[model samples]
Target: MNFNQFKEKYQKFEVEEFPNKVTYSPLVSVLVQTYNHENYIRECLDSILYQKTDFDFEILLGEDYSTDTTREICKDYAEKNPENIRLFLHHPDNKIIINGVSTGNFNAFYNFYKAQGKYIAFCEGDDRWRDPFKLQKHINSFKTNFRLVMNYHSYITVDHNSNLFQTYQMKLQPIGNISGTQLLEGKFHPLLSTTCFKKVFNEIPLEMTQVMNVDTFLISLLGNFGDAIYLKNIFPSAYRIHKGGMWSLKEKKQKYLSKILTFTKLEEFYLSQGNKRLSQFYRDKKANTFKMAAVFYFLNLNFFQFIQNVWNYIKTKFFNLKFL
Candidate 1:
């Protein structure tokens, strides 16, 4: 369809047949947002299709107009498995305007907002669950808990040739007890795809979506209501690490600087947004974020590293450097 036609469709999507029929389904909604993930979409969808949950669930594939054949494959899958898959396919015109730059995150929100299930889970096109019980585990937690958010750890940050570089896990001890103060002080969110929780955001500010860290706003809202559970299971959906991935940008020096400055400013904003003081946990969390930003700043900067070495030598000469 043409761009204008898609725009008209999106404007009316809320009152369409799917919206009206959503309340009839009594189960979780798995929201999958796709751009051009032709290579990985099958494996991703296969994982979801095999979920061992007793309850019913639907897959909402929010597709952006992909330049590749990804949309065709999704269409084929939906047509073949009409019961399990429902495509809220985006028309080309439904593009999001981010600082006038339209990208896939626009479609992410569109699909996310049109969710009809009582609970929601996220799975990006490039990622897939490693375990069959991924959905069932989260669904059980959600059925028993009234908390606004729940997430599990995923295997990310792999080595060359696609192997685990390091096993990663977040501090999940205080799972069901996270407070806004804890979040402000630095309780963090796990991977987006690894999370599944109740639909808690009813009044998200429009501006929050435009910022690069929309997930932060989402988790913040959840943390505001109740504690988010951390499933601690290491074998969650795999977040592929490749050249096309966000963290794999070749312009590390420039990207690092920009992200660091943005996050530092965000940290400050988080502290002051509601006239709030961060909890000790969150304070340490923000501090760690800053430290990561500092390391990332000089990660690929030869000159910056040289200058830093020189500075360290000078400080050592004066016996002024302290590792406190």
Candidate 2:
């Protein structure tokens, strides 16, 4: 289905939109997906609002019925900065559930549908951009190179107290352009907060709703359109690791399970699309991830789990070998 068809199918589950006062078309749409992020939402909004750009942009804030004051805070920001922020109040019933788990896919997908800019940038409610010129820098790269579909920069990992813990760059030396296959092979992993991409596709694949990490799926999907540029000069964004963080707060076992599931679904998705190479690649990755999980269990001295994961790894490896 095309984007218009996708909107037609899912638009009825629409969130309440608070219109912004921006008259001209925005060059970029900043997608901010928030849920129970009252503590960090202000800093996240402020970071985007503080960006110094010659061109206009709009913030597509998807507040997914937070039990905390996140929704109220987002409302206040929308009312105050009517020209820059368009707030969408989402319903809990509209959330996408996979394997009995509710996900932010619905909120994120709705924001993508409503995005009206040439480019869409992502910064979750818990993450903040460190550079005021981030948008300007990304837009400049996009304008200069039409073949570039995505761009990302380095980022700093912050603890719950917002103190910097570690800084991450994609590589030791910058590569000008990275292909889609390279992205899928785990050559570079772009954090959602530090990434921006061209608005190329109207319809998202149905398999996307089944995954745990939408950001990873999205980066790989966009790479199919064009090359991704890595910016070395820009100041890194901040990715907060808090108790409330979705991925950060998960247990090691849970994180490994999520990755295993993600890889399995991605493999299936590529197979359905008739991309045998990518399907086989993900199959190999899935088996390797299982091996890693087994190693983790062994080192943690969880003998039962270690044995189970090792058995799973053996099964997956043998399955792949049969296919080969």
Candidate 3:
């Protein structure tokens, strides 16, 4: 996608006045993007709606067309909570839901531009916050520390059934400053739902749309604005792992393939930003995916794929060629 064209098209992604009549600035904007998450979307929305905060916050439910009842559910929530929920639906009668449409740019494009708050919090349909005070606490931290423009906390890992499997324990006190690299490779980078950052943005960076998993660069981009903090005092969010989720792949080779795609995009992204040093870091990271993919393919006796990945790895690692 031409980012220049994207900028021109959506630079003025007009924040139309809410039909429910909202004038006062909200304290936070909760972004929830979903597709066929009928089982979990309610819990996710409830978790945010139940949050105890003195200030008002709006939920931007970017309802990507879902074949199931996801859009209906979002429509219901928006109607019931007209003052709180804003439904951005891709279809009128779920045609887009059945057939599907290009969601890469618009799903996140609207989420970023349509926000009307000082802070932004993310909660996908499958993720939920453990603490009702999550927003209040993060807002307090931001208010207290002028330097901290970004804040993220820990989260627990849960199965699809909401069964807790492991805890991401971060025992240290709140950190005052964190770097972009540290945020990417740190012990607790945080799930999207676990972060509450100030809504300070100039333009939508090209990287957000170019990659599938924008997790690595999102915090880094936010970190560019100001130092970030990782909180350990509060309750962590619950990140559910299941078959439907994008990140969870049953096969080892598939996992490596996904990682390879993300890391390669990251390398290209870093290169686009003119950070050759970090670009090289992602380049090295991409090698592991290639190596792992090669091993998996060879063991599975997929000779062609194995040889292909091996050649890919050699070119990337030794030749230092930019994939983009």
TM-score of each: 0.68, 0.86, 0.80
Q: Candidate 1: which pairs clash? A: 185-281, 185-282, 185-283, 186-282
- Candidate 2 has a TM-score of 0.86
Comparing 1 and 3 on TM-score, the stronger one: 3
Among these predicted structures, which one has the highest TM-score?
2
TM-score of 3: 0.80
In each prediction, how many residue pairs overlap at the backbone (N, C-alpha, C within less than 3 A)? Answer: 4, 0, 0
lDDT of 3: 0.71
Over 1-324, each residue of candidate 2 has an lDDT whose tens digit, in order, gives 556665565545666988679646999999999999999999999999999999999999999999999999999999999999989998887777765678888789888978899899999999889999999999998888888888888887787679866433324433456886776655566777777888888778877766787776777787688888889878988888743433332367767877877778778888999989888787878888889988987877888988877877787777554221
lDDT of 1 at 27: 75
lDDT of model number 2: 0.81
lDDT of each: 0.60, 0.81, 0.71
**Candidate order, lDDT descending:** 2, 3, 1
* Residue range with the least summed lDDT across 10 consecutive positions in model 1: 14-23
